[model samples]
Target: MRELELKYGCNPNQKPARIYMDEGELPITVLNGKPGYINFMDALNSWQLVKALKKATGLPAAASFKHVSPAGAALGTPLTEVEKQIYFADGFDTSPIACAYIKARGADRLCSYGDWAALSDVCDEATARFLAMEVSDGIIAPGYTDEALAILKTKKKGNYNVVQIDPNYEPAPIETRHIYGITFQQGYNNFEINESLLDNIVTENKELPEAARHDLLLALLTLKYTQSNSVCYVKNGQTIGVGAGQQSRIHCTRLAGSKADNWMLRQHPKVLGLQFVDNIRRPNRDNAIDVYISDEYEDVLAEGVWQETFKVKPEPLTREEKKAWIAQMHGVSVGSDAFFPFGDNVERARKSGVEYIAQPGGSIRDDNVIETCNKYGIVMAFTGMRLFHH
Candidate 1:
């Protein structure tokens, strides 16, 4: 097909929306429901991320996307017992692609609610069964097995968007878009991310473990597709936190660091031990956990409301306890879409247990940033390639 029409644009009021290719037939085929403009936006952007991840790691990959940015992304990695419990991934099919998607969605359950999913490998029955239970809008991949297609067809009362793309289809060298009757064009970003990017280690501490290198590559590739002024924190082949589209670079560091801390805090003993009442909805459970971890636990634990969700009103986790637990988190890797103009970003990242970092490294304050990394004994690299996606 040369074109595919949409019900509406980004919003209901916006009209006359469709996607097409000028030179040839469109590369995607809508296997199921009609996807709106935003759904397609998330699907296409997320597909690129997972595609890069699989190419870099030689493993199945997946992403959970809300809006155009990814909530999380991950490669196929074995999950620990604690991870499965917190993610509610029990009884899952546990295939490689399913594991990747589960870890991606579980990275930030609150943010991933009602997200669009993207997968590197063809959708299998195991992956579809996992997607079936989540609150998601749609999915995109190269293909899907017949059994997987059957399972996905039942999602969202059979209105779920399922898309298949030509894995070999390549876009033109230049891309274009329009805004307010003005047209803009630019060459597509085709710079590759790989282990060689880490060869330019600039920190005094040069100990980049194999696993840390893997994570740093993951972080860089994730930031490549993320919106500009972004930061990504990754560990063990999964993105635990992503701060995208911030105007200030330091804000990106702080925002992504706080999210990384929250990911670690969720694995705390108190959080893992919380007991919820029977029949609690998934979103509600997520909210309860979030409120319980926040400084103001009273919002969810007020005298009359605590009993509604929890079996026993658990004692509030204190700030001291949170800080102590966060300090225990270690070996995290971080990446930035642009240069860090100051050393403050390093300070903020270190607080979230960052030990390795990757960035373009062309700032005037590169010395200060390296000094701060030395103080924390953190390893950092300069890729000499900026990744500023909009």
Candidate 2:
């Protein structure tokens, strides 16, 4: 079918919504529920992200997307025992793709609520089962196994959006969009992110390890699809934090760095040992944990609100403890859609244990930025390519 009508556009009043191909049949089939305009937007953009990730890493990849930006993305790296526990995936046989989704969603659980999921490989039963347990709006993949499809079809009262795209389908080189009755066109961003782009080390410390190269590649690819003025922090094989659509470059860095700090704090012994009342929902637990880690935990404790989520009055994760915990984070890789204009971005990133960086390197204050990285012994690369997405 060339055209698929939608219930509405981005909003209920934006009527007469649909997606269609101008020349050929559409590449996707809606195997389950009808997806709206925003859902399809998230699905298509997220699909491209995972596709590029798998091609670059030679592993299965997954992404969690919200409002056309990725909340998290990752390759299929094996989960450690601590990772499995923190991600709430304690027991169950899992496949590579399943592990990818788990890590992707776990990167920022609060942001991934009601997210759209995308996978580089076909959906297997294990992956579907894991997806079923999450709070998600829909999913898109090349294909699905029978058991996987059956399980997904049962979610959201059989109204979950399940999209299947042809793996071989490719769009034209030129892409177009419209806003306010005007047309805007551009060549699709086909820039491939790999180790080659990260070879231009400009910092005093020029040592870039193989693992750091992979993480930098992951960060850059994620930023490519992220909204402009964005920064991403990646470690191991997954994105730990992504700050998208910020106006200032420093704000982006600080926002993403704080998120990275939160991701690290979740693994702290204190956070991991928080006792909750029996049968508390995952979302509630997530919110409670977030509050517990923030500075407002003392206020929550004083207000006696902790009784609703935790079994006992938990000790506040003091400011000193959080600082000490974040200091231990290291080898983090950060990528920017554009250049950093000041050294403050570097200062904030270093607090979150960022030791490697990649940016376009066109700012007037490049000397200052490089000097800041040198002081911290951070290795930075000037990719000289801007990756701004809307």
Candidate 3:
């Protein structure tokens, strides 16, 4: 089909929503459910992210997207036992793509709630089973197996949005959009991210290990599709945290750092051992655990709110405990879509265990930033490529 109409735009009041192609048929087919404007936005952007991830890593990839930004993205990697428990899949021999999707969706389940999913590889039964357990709006992938299609068809009472796109489809080099009767045009950003981008190591510690390089590539690929003024923290083939669309570089670092800290805090013994009521649902447990770990726990704890989510009054995860747990985190990689004008970004990222970094590295105070990395023995590379997205 050349065009597909939508029920509405970003909101219900916006009328006459549709997507079309000028010279050829649209590259996707809607197998189920009616996708909204925002759903399509999430799917298209996330699909690009996963596609880049898989191409960069030569592994299956997935992304959990909300609005137009990714909540998490990951490449296929073996999940630890603790990770399987938290992700709620303990006994399954998950496919590489399935594990990638689980890690992507599980990175921040709270943020991923009702998210749109995108997969790099064809959807398999294992991936469908994992998706079945999550709260999601829709999914977009290149293809789906028969078993996977059957399983996904049962989601959302058989109305789940399932989109299949041409794996080899590529858009024209230029793109255009309109806003308020004004048309905007630009060349599509097809900048390739690869090992060659990590050649310029300005830090005294000139060590971007193979794993660290892979993590750095993951972060850069994620930032390519993220909104402007974004930073991403990655570890072990997954984006642990992403801060997008911030005004200040330091704010981006701080925002992503806090999320990285939360990711680490979730694996803390106190958090992992929390005893919930026998029948507490996964979503409720996620919320309760987040609340228990936050500094605002006193507010949630004061009114006996814990009783609703936990069987017993679990010990509060105190600020001190949080600090101690975060301190132990290491081997993290950070990427910036643009240059860090000041050393403060480095200072904040270090607090969240960022040991390696990649950025365009043309700031006026590049020496200061390099000195800061030296203090922490952090290895940093100048990719010399800005990944600003809008």
**lDDT winner among the candidates?**
2
Q: Write the per-residue lDDT of candidate 2 for residues 17-117, one digit (tens) a residue.
A: 99999989999999999899999999999999999999898989999999899999999989999899888998856899999999999999999999999
List pairs with backbone clashes in candidate 2.
none
Alpha-carbon TM-score of each model against the true structure: 0.98, 0.99, 0.98
Per-residue lDDT of 224-286 in model 3, one digit per residue for the tens?
999889999999999999999999999999988888888888888878888888977778878
**1-390 in candidate 1: lDDT tens per residue?**
898888999999898999988989998999998999999999999999999989998989999999899899998988889889888888787888989999999999999999999999999998999899889999999999999999999999999999998988877999999999999999988888999999999999999999999999889988988888899999999999999999999999998898899899999999999999999988899988988899889655665688878999898998999999999989999999999999999999999999999999999989999999999999999999999988
Model 3 vs. true fold: TM: 0.98
Q: Which stretches of candidate 2 lie over 4 Å from their true place?
A: none
Ranking by lDDT: 2, 1, 3
RMSD in angstroms, candidate 3?
A: 1.0
Model 3: colliding residue pairs: none
- Report residue 46 deviation for candidate 2 (angstroms): 0.2
Q: Model 2 reaches what TM-score against the true structure?
A: 0.99
lDDT (Cα) of model 1? 0.92
Which 10 residues in a row give candidate 3 its minimum summed lDDT?
Answer: 84-93
